[model samples]
Target: MQFDRKDKNDATLLDLYTQLLYPRMVEEKMLILLRQGRIGKWFSGIGQEAIAVGSALAMKETEYILPMHRNLGVFTARDIPLKKLMAQWQGKISGFTKGRDRSFHFGTQEYKIIGMISHLGPQMAIADGIALADLIADKKQATLVFTGEGATSEGDFHEAINVASVWNLPVIFLIENNGYGLSTPINEQFKCKDLVDRAAGYGIEGVQIDGNNILEVYDTLSDLAEKMRKDPKPVLVECLTFRMRGHEEASGTKYVPQELFDLWAQKDPVKCFEEYLLEQRILTPESIAEIKADFKAGIEQEVEAAFLEEEPVADTATEMQDMYAPHPYQPVEPNQQSAEIRYIDAITDALKIGMQKHNNLVLMGQDIAEYGGAFKITDGFVDLFGKARVRNTPICESAIVGAGLGLSINGYKAVVEMQFADFVTCGFNQIVNNLAKTHYRWGEKADVVVRMPTGAGTGAGPFHSQSNEAWFTKTPGLKIVYPAFPFDAKGLLLSAIEDPNPVLFFEHKYLYRSLSGQVPIGEYTLEIGKANLIKEGEQLSIITYGLGVHWALSYLDEHPEINATLLDLRSLQPWDKEAVAAAVKKTGRVLILHEDTLSSGFGAELSAWIAEHCFEQLDAPVMRCASSDTAIPMSKVLEESFLAKSRLKESIDKLMAY
Candidate 1:
């Protein structure tokens, strides 16, 4: 154990032998497996092992490590079981995701590691949020998130680091500047001398080190990790390493120059360290060979056993449960003398209630603190909950949601305001890909509520007024709650904040004041998937949500003879299938309507469902009324014509006549 190391650990640099060997062995084995048609794809950290192993060893086991796709050394350093790792590579049901996913896209709570998705930049923000969660809870722990120099080009990288800097979060933004981002060279990426130099823009400490020197990385990070406990803040560390292999095993490196490759090959971190250890007389040749043999033997045994494990069978009955894991609805009878408030006010009330009940509840968005948000939904949240809880962020949707995801996984319920639902496009990657798939990928909980102000009625135009529920309806793991009234807005928000999954709460901008109801004054969580059967009838059934539900009511009031059942489908995903089936079966004819454009709207899916399941009871073809298949025009006349009452009336008349 004798070695030249000044790390916080009592252990010497020799302890990293196993950590260094593991990822290299895994890379070799994965390449073999890929050739044998056993594994799909592999991104090898062939030259960057020192960065991963050293940084991971530098931090405590309690601290979190959010790894990138190529950070296999992090998993190795974390001491993840060889058998489980092999099983994951083999895509066995015994793996982290139950063989539902493959590759480096799985993580578990036990390891304090977050799995990597394809987009690496967003994880930086998630790391920020996890660090923020601990900071708010008075916990002393930091987060280490890794990425390649290529990821620095992403907007999320800037957004994430900026937020980390602003909050002084205990996060280590590590960049493996591996010369090339997949295939594009570093010169094509940025003008900065070193990637760490970008840290100056965020007003954080920037340091570049010889990543091949494992002792240097270990000592630096170990000391930094200790300092973070006392004074938490972000540190940008650039590990000047090389990706010896291509982006993936199959992506050959013809674009790399032979001379540069030869130079780096001579400076291989593992080979260099092994030579140094031998020179220092730490571990003899026989001991090093023995250690290598043990790693190889264990890897061979695990790979063989994992290869023989039974494949995951598709039991859709259980597999489908990953789409929406709703919190079980506890029957909450609202107390008497409950105050009634406007829909917008009720939103604030729900946030207050959520914060009061759960100290872990947090809110983040642009203009959400001092200005109280673009719509003032979080008017007093900052004052009441304090700046740490209710944070005002720059206009970075992806970072907000990404950090929200981080907060949720770290025992905090995070509410992210999208400012405008239309702008959700900015954070679409975080919300749809990561947030929607976290649970399904690794069985990880993502308790995030993305509050989106949706719909067009006040001439807010396409950018501000979009019924984007259809966008998320297509995503599997997200629960879409479009509250049509004040009571549902408050109750469903409470439920959303309480739910153990990511929920997209769409509050209709037009209905913010146009619709109101007697909301319960006390804490109450309404059932998420259940629809409010606004009006019951026998002739025609109208399935709608959000502002469409109100429009249906207006039409029903004007034409009593239509004999319609207005179903306010509050939750779009994990929708009340039983209620919808019964309602459609009872009414024979169904009309699906929404404020979103007709083409590919949720109404299309509803129409198809009715045609598929309730065709036997149907006397007429299902009718659908929606805004025309065009952008919501800025002109009031054009917008009105696009979503006119006449469209609904015509559709109803045809259904009745049929």
Candidate 2:
């Protein structure tokens, strides 16, 4: 049954049958293990093996493939070691994600495969990003992404496809029409006759084929992949198939119609392909029996080896080791020669420096290219870096953020600008779930910088003005920095760009043109996790960040005899706890300040930390100065009343008096 080099070249019948049968046999063995309670769960791809196997075999190994839970054949056809894959399913330490994730939820860079997240459609945009990286490098590589018919209804699917079509990226959107998404039927999933018909809405080529037929899937994808490498463009392919088994073994198939099951049973891909191979003399009944015996024996051996491997232990050191990629603090002092620039101009200078230094760095946001962004921060960037590097993206924040993660996966850095900080809620999932967890989940570097234009003093309404740093501060694996002065703004931004993890840079919109300082004309990066002591004193400590730092300095300037120390914590996630503790110990009384709502603000966390760590050193109880709990108002008078400035002086006076 072994094929020689000559047979491998022309014996498509034998080659495909082996490829298709491998996953089928592997899944059959896995089901046995599942029943024995050896593995936790399994997403059975028993009936639709041909789709994954054929597609994977036809594509080039250098190209990238993004697969979902049901695409087990894709892994098997790529010849991933069965022992390691079984170890992954068994939650062993030898697994790709080291038991952090289960099933096909992890990707391996060596295999050029990026795994899908539970949120179905985001991988589509990620594929667009991978293809974009290749297009930018002028490499003839195409990316293939998979999704279910049900996921096509998601906004991510539409946004990703539209972007791919408009940009002409070399991506193939493969929809495995498996009839049911969990329990929901196709009738409820979409109204169109076929999923491929939706491709026309995105203005792309569309095709539908019998997914059960391995020959058809292989032939069609191979041609399309070649064409894409030579001439990059997006294409949608719908593989018409059925889920012969329950979604998972635990989920019974009782909800499906018996007649539908009976009809699909007759067209079983494995049985149909076997008949064709037998009729063409490509495989004899005895030869098939021999192959099955060989496959079973090999699979059982691998499974046994995987079971003997050690399970992942939940040790504190192991758990916290890779929460974020290691980024050591490297401080570059500001140059002696400097020029006074606004906060917005400092941000622009930092970006220009980063772009000039790293050729693979890319900038993406709405109206960022020609219109120069809403705040004109990137006004002349497109002319300097060209449209490919300084690109304007659609208003779909979720997709763009996911695309940034994709770009990072391919060794390219991306900076995504959110016009208004409050609008980041639209991309919350990608930021917290995907970008923040990429490194901890699978050891993938998420070198993405999200520039958030934040704060609220412009009377720009509640929607436009919000201090939402607390939202991301709660999420682990993200670095948050809010700089008040132009010097700090330029330096911290440059450091964030180089950090090998996701960093959120919050720029106060009110200080964009209002605040100016002597910034270093050349490249420089300040330490991210260090606190800056703007003013030093004795009796009390005023701890704050962003615009609050400015407020505290002004308050201290107004009362020179107050004798209070001011500490500006530029970074939130890895705040300078050592500096804050030292300052609190020096000054018996401490006051925490922020523009966010008083209830459950970041100040609360700082107060709790101070109370826990610096409690014995304090002469008075920890105090907090923050805005009211109500939403920011549109009217200037209401906004003035809503902000924390009105209460800042009172809180500081009370603290110093204590």
Candidate 3:
């Protein structure tokens, strides 16, 4: 396909005008819905219709689009039914979410339109991933991501653009420079003279277009989209537009400058484009009026249809659904076999076995390929499995995880490795908002396992030495697992790989080589949500997971008089409440321990659950042992002082005394 720099002939001006006007009516109708209490709050793309409509028209239906919250125009242009969009806003079954997603968060697989994530900038990284999938699938489709100019300042935008440029992915990043981000002007948010110029730093072509000029937008985007599909290089286009209304229906424009608002209103894309069409003799005054009337009528019809539409009955049931695709719940046999194996080797063995069994599985991370990964967990596998299966990615965390989500969406099992658990924050948005909720919102499954080397006590400073499992455990729909011994690591990891949901598998860096335990030689799997009883006692129940279980067991061994039951919660989500209740009932005491900080830690949740369910059996108040609320220090002495260990035994002893 040849890239065209010129606009379509004047003959298509009427169609362009009609397309441009449709989104405006949609926006107005949505505002009405909001005012009448038919829909919740909405972010409007009033003055920026041209950029959304024109760019959308530039691409073919097969091309993918990842829109932002304010891109209702783009959604309309892509043929998403107005009633469905309204239903989504109204939290009804007729909506794309089936009544679960937040307002403006709607997706359609058939339309090739990924939903708009409320997060500001992470969609750019996701767009790059989708583009990468297209490349791998050998599909001739370009991926377009839309974001506000303010989103350009986010770390994700920088990371995604850099990776996209380096990989030369077929992605077109369209920044709707709508003058202000919420209330702050773009000038105060970014140092660059133009948002597009920032793209140059990533070694990608950058262009700025008149956002109100539909012809210019269509011409530039169509050209770039085609060029990207053919040559496959990232391009950044900044659309200088205006936000005619407040950020959302709830916000007011009392803070905005009246003069600037007036100037932008004069340059409204709809009015400006109509005049331009008339000047070119493509649209007469009567034709323009007729087009506007027709669009308004169409929008009203859509609204009426949406109001009368029957919401899907299945939407209510979908909310309580599990992450598993095709099926929700299936009981599995627990791990029973026991044999000695190394922790790190167990991880490698699980990956090898899972990959050999499941051809759809693909593993990628920095130094993971021939380098065998930083911890050598993926050693000797790239050569045997080939680069396609065991791939090495750039040191871009956001891009790596985002691409992993995209790959998972395209029917590939992705095992993404983060060198250290602390660094996973770089891709937090991808994990929390995208991968974690894909199944919950879009009714699609993401069987991606994110493996990270976590925990401190290894003299690696604050940045390198930290346990962030708690950070991810708080997110919904993500299964968090931390294994102390080798056998559980293998079994739990195998289960995570097979489970059709996103899993955060935290491998303690210190325990990988230091800890040794029995792991079965053959294929074995552990139930995701079930906890194990390491020791059965009567005095107290120490609820812990990962390395904490080891410490608790060690304490139990030392104090023969102290009969404390230890529970290792392998899976954080869908936790074993029954086992916990049973342990508390038998022991009549509860103590929660973890390596994370005390404030809002995983231990708090466990304590709360125990209190809510097993309060009657408690002999004394439930106590929690956790690290101090501070960044993990670099000094070994300080790190040791910060972590919770034998002090927990003291707390237990004190509780026993109480």
Candidate 4:
């Protein structure tokens, strides 16, 4: 139980004990708060406090820590204000998210701690991104990510670890195996007895230790952290602990037998560690009682302070803060000559322009280099940009996006191709948690662009025939752009590549070859967030984007009497709220349309915004035109009926009647 290292002195042990006890008291207080209805439900890290505190102590404050939901212990140990922590539990504006986020979804970049992404298994990938950023900065700081045994089942965990091993990233994957993943026990979750064994598959070193032993956890983590600092490779440490409480405060022990609970109770990690401390003559019973009493009083005082704190007023201007860096939008010159161009050619030209302007630019995806990408958008890019700049990766979506994040932090303008937009779901964690929140969390920009071929009506069917722009639109910090014409495609793409934030550039597969438009011959970039008025009218505003804009334009050509204003929102985030509001006010009628599902679709956001801001200007109720909630079918007849055009025409007719 004792350490031989010189650093492991009495002072270190006292610090470790203090670290362990504080989080324990916080977790206990949170459970009581939940019962009293003062705070929301919580995920407790009761018995596993030793592992959380110990591993956190081993890491320097300069190093980044990406914690999972159960790492409240580590957050407390890292000096995250106890009052703020309690405020987060109470769902108050004083919390990290200002009451926008749920309990356990807290974070502070000031502490060098990346926020805990609520997703079950993306923390490992995010850790890789932080480490990559550190490496790019030429700093020695490392990244440590905490997860549970259950998360190992996710493909992102393996994909992230594998890439980290291949690149020798300075990251430590700390798996807190508390025997159960919610309800499924570790024994039933995986065939292997030890989760660390899986690390061998990725050609990485793996270790297992007694998570209950604070000293043991500290020694192992400190040793690995030192190794990571020097060699800079990914390591997995499976800390075998036990869940002393239910998964969450709301989860009862109905499935867990009473006998098994009694058996595990005797070996409770907190109690066992306390006994060890007593047996080693490290402390007396009276001293332990005094420590507990002090912790309780401290927590009570922090809770009182948090409850007395005033809530932050919701600011409308703050919404525009992290959307993109503060750069004045420059309009393309009116004299710029236009020429007919192909969609793929436009993409290639945009990449070339982006790379020439930004020396830190990097393009990556499966078959993107020599193979020229699945759609030939990157054809000859490797030869033109060199292998270092344009690289082809293996068919691992999670790894591809995860590594892209890493490279971006190193000062690279990364343009990652998802092959097809449908495949983006595979790397959803990297897109949503890491890329989307990078700017919002740290105020540091990640100039990364994700290019994916989207939309149905191309016979791609179910998996391949999805329009996923709605997904990214729902997520904050990401600028979603879907260009219908080749000109906007090139111009908007160049803007996305140049911008100092994440952009989800969606391309319609059908429009790549089927549609042709005039694009400027020379270098010119278009501003994102500006809506293009294809046709100005006063009868009704036909608000739409992407391919839907083409449909609205065509419909406008036939129905000139309707005098509908066709608004093409080139960017979904930081969308032209001003233009939309003005158009809605002038028209006195509005029709929101998109090619996404009707329920919880991107149109809902547009409708909600208009209803809140331009409600008084409306002459009629706001109308929505979107695809049905059913999945995209293979039949052309079914697709035509379910797509945006049919819905657009019908909704427009109804709006005119009103």
RMSD of each: 2.2, 2.4, 3.8, 5.0
Candidate 2: residue pairs that collide: none
Question: What TM-score would every model get versus the actual structure?
Answer: 0.96, 0.98, 0.88, 0.79
lDDT of each: 0.85, 0.90, 0.81, 0.79
- Tell me, by TM-score, which candidate is best: 2
Which one wins by lDDT: 1 or 4? 1
Clashes of each: 0, 0, 2, 0
- Backbone clash total for model 3 is 2
Ranking by lDDT: 2, 1, 3, 4
Candidate 4, superposed: residue stretches over 4 Å from native: 1-7, 28-40, 135-141, 252-300, 312-341, 356-362, 380-414, 428-448, 456-462, 470-478, 498-502, 513-523, 535-545, 548-567, 572-658
lDDT by residue (tens digit), candidate 4, 471-540: 8887878888888889889989988887778899999888888887788886788888888888788899
Name model 3 segments beyond 4 Å from true. Answer: 1-12, 30-42, 99-102, 249-267, 276-290, 309-339, 386-396, 559-564, 597-600, 620-642, 655-658
Q: Which scores higher on TM-score, 3 or 4? A: 3
Model 2 spans with C-alpha error above 4 angstroms: 1-10
User: What TM value does model 3 have?
Assistant: 0.88
How far out, in Å, is residue 50 in model 2?
A: 1.1
Per-residue lDDT tens digits for candidate 1, residues 1-658, read 1235553332365687667767887788878878988778887888888899999998899889998877888887888887888788767889898887777788789999987788778888889889999999879887899888999999999999998999999999898889998889999999878888898888999989888777778878887888887899999999888888888878989999999889998778888878877786777889888988888888899888887887898988777786666467776666676676788988988888898999888888888998898888888777788998889888888888999999988989899998899999999999888999888888878999999988898987878878888888988888899988888898899888888899999998887776667877788878888998888899989899888887888878877777778888999986888888888888988888888889999989988888898889888898888889888888999889987354998888888889
Q: Cα deviation in Å at residue 640, candidate 1?
A: 1.0
TM-score between model 4 and native? 0.79
